[model samples]
Structure formats: structure tokens, C-alpha cells
Target: MDNAVRNRAWRMRRKPAGLVQQDDLELVTEAVRALAPGEVLLRLVHVSLDPGQQVYMQSTQELPGGTIWPGDVIRAWGVGEVVESRSDRFPVGSHARDHHGVAGVQEYAILPEAALILVDPEAAPLNAHLNILGMPGLTAHAGLSQIGCLQPGETVVVSGASGAVGAAAGQIARIRGCRVVGLAGGPEKCAHLTGELGFDAALDYRSGRLAADLTLACPDGIDVYFDNTGGEILDICLGQMARKGRIVFCGAIAAYGSGDSRGLTNYLRILTHQVRFEAFAYYDYEPHFASALAELAGWMQAGLLKHREDVAVGLENFVPVFHHLFTSGISGKLVLQVRDGVTR
Candidate 1:
């Protein structure tokens, strides 16, 4: 094991403003110390740039004692290969994915064996581990099956439907025989959701007539609502929900970096309609991960599932590429390819 290896990482420079700026993250280089027992040195290949990163930076939420601060290594989900191993769990040259949140936005990461989930590159493309076969896929399965308790012939509505989690959730619901409707930002994404992803309907939320479009698409009323962008769209869905509907609150990208809350005036409908509103984290359902992964893998192999990735090449381009996540209308999962030729 080489203790002289240099690691380049991106740390939070400061809390973001209205939108994430380049100054919010600073790249730093440090020498990697030798691994301890049960530790493995990982060479990061693909780092997931998720909307949750923005929430972690601004929110006061903390692990146990302290909140995330400037100079702290920005936590992320990534795929890496074990370069040096002191544990049998992760032998050298084996690829693994972060379990909960140990991996960060760095070229090299030293993680304990317990935090690493062994991945098979031969099963699917390496980047798929960061998208459909990763946390987003688990989030979708848990939210739809467990939280939403989705049933066949039910009308399901998913906001931010073209996004990673949202897209997966919609497809999962569709596979379960639900009539899935998606709400995306533009016509292009809406088209992709309906045309490619097999959603029953795709509505452009940016269109002023969200209520009208939703009514037209979901004539049966929404039995389940998978919310990723919680704001006006959520309120609209809440008002149009069927009696005893279920809402799985997965993400609130609409409120991220805005520093302002869009109060849900229609929350009273939860009581009137007897709706069940539940918020879930993917890690909370870890016990069911193996089943979910097997199902998702089978669907992919049988051509029942499809996934897209918007990859941004180069580690140095992390800042601008991260900013592109919010501003640019890039669809699918956003991943940072820190190193190339290793996966392909």
C-alpha cells in the first residue's frame, strides 16, 4: 500500500447563495495516510451529484453533534475500486459503491468495510451503480412499494418525473400496473417520460395550466403522489388527490437554495381527504435492499427498465458541472466522471 498517494477533494467553502456558485466549493489536495485495519483505499470513478447535496450544505441538519461547515469534505455517493485493502470485505481491484454516505467528492476515499457495498461491473455499466442500481433506485422502490403502498390500476402522479429518483419511481409504479403520470419542467423531458419511460401521461409543470393538464391526464384522480419537487406542484397535486390517497415525500428540490419556503396552503386536504403523507429516507429501508436490487436488475435485464445518465467529465469541472445540475435542463442522473477508461 502506498501511503504517499495524493488525494484531491472538493470541500464546502461556504453556504450557497440563491444558486450554487463556484466559490461555494474549494478543491484541496492532501497526502493519503496508510489505511488502518479493516480499511480500504478506494480510487473514485463516478461521483453522484445529487440535489440532496444542496440541502446538506444549507440545512442545519447534522449527523450527531455538529453541522456541516466550510472546509468539510462534501459528502456524496460514488462508485470506486479498491486499490489497497486491509480487509477481506473489499479485496484489491474489486469495485464497490458507498452504502449510506461515507464516500465524498474526492479522487481517493478511505472507507471502512462496513460502509462499502460490493458491486459487479459485469452486471451493468459502472455508472448505473450511481443511478438506477444505487440509492435512487432504492429510494424509488421503497417510496412506491413501501411508503406509497401502490396498487395495480391505481393512478399515480410523480413530480420532477424526469429526475433520477422520480424517473425510477414512475417506472416502478408503471411496472406494477399503475397508471403513472409525470410532471417535468419542459416539453422535452415530458416527452421522454411518456414516449420512452412508458408513463401514461406527462405534463409540463412549467405550463401555467398545471391544474387543467393534471385534471385531463388523471381523470380518475391521483391515488398516489410521488413528490420530488415540493412547492406549488405539490399543492396542486394535493388538491386533486383521490380520497385516502398516499403521498411519498422523497425530495424537495423546489425549495433548495431558494432560502424561502412555499407554504402548502392545501395541506388541510390531508385531513379532509384522509390522505396519508409519509416522508422516507432510502437508508431507513436497508433491510429490503437486496430484494429491491434483484427486482430492478431483472427489469433492466429483461428490457423492462431503462436509465439515462448525464455525465460530466473531469474532476476539475466539478463546480461548474454541479451548478449545471440546477440551472441546466439536463435530464437523467448527473454524475461526475473523475477518471475515465477504468470503467469502459
Candidate 2:
């Protein structure tokens, strides 16, 4: 372990106004400081790019204020290989990641022992830990089973269905015997939802026929609506919810870019339909993570659940790739390869 080793990370340069621009962040290089007795030196392999993390770069109504300040490293969830370790929990050459702490957008990280979670590279692709086997999959499971109270034979609708959490939620609903319908932005994503991920039906929200298309897909009304995009799509789902239905509020990607938080006029349907509208935060269900991961892994191994990742190589591509989330530039879980030539 050498303190002379250099680390590269993306640091916030300015508070982004609407969408995060390239100029808002700066690529910084510094010497990797020596690890303490209970710390680990990680060569970050893949960094998970999520829509919610973008809000930390700027303020939004949901978050109220920005959590990250200028000059701070952009935080994300990521998997890394322990190249040097002063802790027994994380040995040299072991793979680990953190969903609970700041796994920044960097090529190398010096993290505390408690902040790391060990992952098996042989169990699944290393990147899988950042997606289906990680937060996105766990979020989907907890939302559907614990929050949504999803039942077999019920009709479940997922908005932003091609994205990470949405994709997992739709498949998990299907695995649990629900008739799953997905809504996405384009025809290609819609097709991938139904044809690849096994969603029962898919509708393009960009077609300007969302209401009619959704109505046709869920003739009996949606029993559980996994809402990832919380704008007009949410309002449409609100009006079409079945009696005693549930709405799992996982994300608000629709408002993230535009900053136009269109209020749901059909919110009154919550009372009329006796619906349960609840927001999901994965930390609330942390106690169940091990079991959830095991189940998701089994599903993946058994060919029941499938996950996709849009991996962009090099740390330099982080800014443009991160912007892709809102523009639908990539499909599935977005990941940035911070280090090159590390075989998966």
C-alpha cells in the first residue's frame, strides 16, 4: 500500500440549476492517503449512477435542500476491489461495496471497515451488486411485498419500467404471480419491458395516449402502482387505481430534470378508492436485506429474474452518462467503469 498512489474523483464545482451539467463538476486528482488500522483501500470498479443521487447535487422540493456542497465528491453506490486492507473484514483482493455510505465517483477510495459490504464476484457479475443484487432489487422487493401488499392475480402497473428499480419491481411482481404492466418513454424501452423482462404489457408514456393505453392494458384497474416517475403518469395511475389499491412511491424522475412538479389532481381518488399511497426508502427495510438478496440471487440463477446494465467505460464519461438517466439515453441500471482492464 503506497500513499504515493494517486486517486481521481469527480467533485462538485457548482450547484446544478436544473439538470446536472458537465461544468458543475470537476475531475480531481489527489494522493491516496494511507489507510488507518480499521480502514480499507479500494480500487473502485463500477460506480452506480442513480437518479435520486442527482438531487443531492441540487435542491428539490422532495429533498427540500441539497445535501452535497461544492468541492465535495459526488457520492454514489458502487462495487470495488480491496487492493489494500488494514481490516480483517475486508481482505486484500476481496470485492466490496457500500449502499449505506458515500461510495464516491472515483477510481480509488479509502473507506472505513464498517462502511463496506463484502460481495461475491463469482456469484454474479461484479456490476450486479450495484443493481439487482443491491439497492434497486431490495427496494423493489420491499416496496411490493411489505409496502404495496402485492397479491397474486392482482394487476400491477410500473412506471419508468425500464429503469433499475422499476424493472426489478415489474419482474418481482410477475414472479409473485401478478399481471404486470409497464410504462416507459419510448417504443424500444416498452418492447424491452414486455419482450425481455416479461412484463405482461407495456405502454409508451411518450405516445400521448398514456391514459387510453393504460386503460386498455389494465382493464380491471391497477391493484398496485409502482410509481417511479411522479408527474402526469402518477396522476393517471391515481385515477385508475382499483379499490384498496396501493401506490409505491419509489422515485420522481419526471420532475428531477424539468423541476416542474405537477400536482396530482386525481389524488382525491386515494380516498374514493381507499388506496394506500406510501413512499419507499430502502433503509427502512434493512433488516430484510439478506433474505431479499438471497431470493433475488436465486431468481437470477434460476433464470426467473433478468437484469440489464448500461456500463460506460472510463471516469471521464461520468458526467454525460449521469445525464442519460433523465433523457432515457441508456437502458437498465446505469454504471460507470472507474477503472479499466479489471476483468469481471
Candidate 3:
């Protein structure tokens, strides 16, 4: 790794509305010099494009030197390998996770020890660390442990059953010995959830008449409802909660694009059902993230957990894979494969 190699990346050309579009991007290729000291050059393996990026594109200027400008490289967390390193903490052949907003998409990028989390192959797949064993798992764990206060034998219902974070929550609920029911968009996804993911029952939200379907699924009443989708779905879940039931709000994918939050007329259900609703934000539980990862790795190794990643090749495909998050159709984790680097 002697001669300097230039890298191409997708730079946000302008702020995006609803979803970040490719047209808002521009590619810039520049030769990066060889590392001097305490620096590691990484070849990005995978890039994560999450639905929350809409917020990043909107208000990046609020942070100190963190503004999302046209010339700035797109920032994201991804697993990469150190091809050349001047620091022992990040040695050659080492794999690390970088927090710098934009790094992947380029064939090569430079990273520092502080920006990485060195990983072992035995722990989990590189992508898994960025996915199920990473933020998605944390989201599920924090929501369940905190907001849901999930109890054994309680009937817990989760929306977006087949997507990455939602699917993870369902599995965790099952492990807790709770009767798990999922609400997803399609029949195929519903079938996969109940048949393979150990969900006791799954309702296809795409079929309409969700209220009736939910009744058939949760005959004992919903004890813990994890509402990932807002709007009418939340309205329905609110009306169906058992007395003293808990509600955890993990995400509002249902309201992201339209920019219109829901107004529920079912406020009376809270008093009648004695329901407790808690909004969940994963960043609030970052201190316990280590414990969450430790448990996730053990579960994965013991074959008690499973994960799926939807990969998009090249930097150009990050937008499309990301759009799947808002779509009611796509399931599993969405990731961008910048280059071949590592697996479990």
C-alpha cells in the first residue's frame, strides 16, 4: 500500500425530503496519501443505510462541524479492514467499525483507532455487528427491557414483524416465553414470521381489516404492544390493549415520509384499559449497549437467534436498498456491500 489511491464516494449534493435520493448525490474521487502514524487505511466491507438518515440530511448543520454539506463525504458506520496501519491498536489485517459519518462507498478510506471497534471473527459476522448484533438488536432489547417490561407468558404484539429491528424484537419476545404475535405487510412475510421465526401468529396488514385480524390473533388481549408503525395501526393497537398493558414505541416508519404524525381519537382506551405507553429511543440506553451485544453474540453462537441481511452492491445502490425501509414490502436488514472484506 505504497502509492496513493483515489477513492470515489457519494457526497450529498443537497438536503433531501422524506428519503435521500441519488440525485441529491455527487461522486468525488481523490487520491488519499499513505498513512503516516496512528492511522489505518480501511477497505470498507459493508455500509448501513438506515431510515433515520432522513433526520441527518435535514439537520446536520446543528452539530459542530457536522453539517451535511454538498462537498462533505457521506458518513455512516460500516465494517472495514486495516490494509495498512501505523498504529498497533489498529494493525494490518484488523477489522474495525468506524463512526465517521462517511467512509464507505469508496474503494479505500482512512480510519483511526478511536473511530473503530476491533472485532473477532468468532464473535459475529462483520455485518451482523452492524445489524442484528448491533443497533437493531439494541433497539429491540432496550424497548423490551425498558418500555415493554416484558413478562413471561404475556401476550406481546410487534408491528413490522419481518424487518430487521421488528424481527429481532419478535425473537426476543419469544425467548422471554411470551406469546408473540406479529403484524407485517404481506402474506409471504406473515407466513415466514409465524412459520420460521417462531411467532405464534402473524397478521398481514396489507389485507386491510387489521382490527378483525388482530382480534383473531390476540384472543387473550395484547399485554405488551411494540408499535413500530404509527398512524391507524397505532390507533388499532391502542384500542386492543389489555388492562394494565404496556406499549413501547420503537419507530414511526409509518409517519416518516408523509411528515405528518398521527392524531389518535382512541385516547379513552388508555383510561379504560389502564395502558402505559412509553416512547423508546435506543440512544437513551447506550450505556447498556455492551450488555446487549454480549447477550446477542451468545444467542447467535448458541443458534438461538437468526439474522438476515439484504445487500446492495456498490455505493450507487445505497439509496434503493434504503427506500425499502419505508416500503411495506421489504424485509430483513438492508446493507451496502462496498467491497469483500469479512464474514462472521
Q: Model 1: runs farther than 4 Å from truth?
A: 63-67, 340-344
* Residue range 1-344, candidate 3, lDDT tens digits: 45466777877888876567888877777777778677788777887776556556656466432546666677766777778888889878877776444455566777767666687755667788667877788889899997888899999999977888888999999998999999988788889898778899999887879999889888878999998887888889888999999989877777776676869878798999899988866767877877888888787777767898877677666677667777754567877888543432
Instruction: List model 1 lDDT by residue over 132-181, tens digit each.
Output: 99989989999998999988999999998898999999999999999999
Write down the lDDT of every candidate, Cα atoms only: 0.87, 0.89, 0.78
Provide the clash count, candidate 2. 0
Residue 293 error for model 1, in Å?
Answer: 1.1
lDDT of 2 at 9: 92
* Structure candidate 3, residue pairs in collision: 74-102, 75-101, 75-102, 76-101, 125-344
Model number with the top lDDT: 2
Cα RMSD for predicted model 2: 2.0
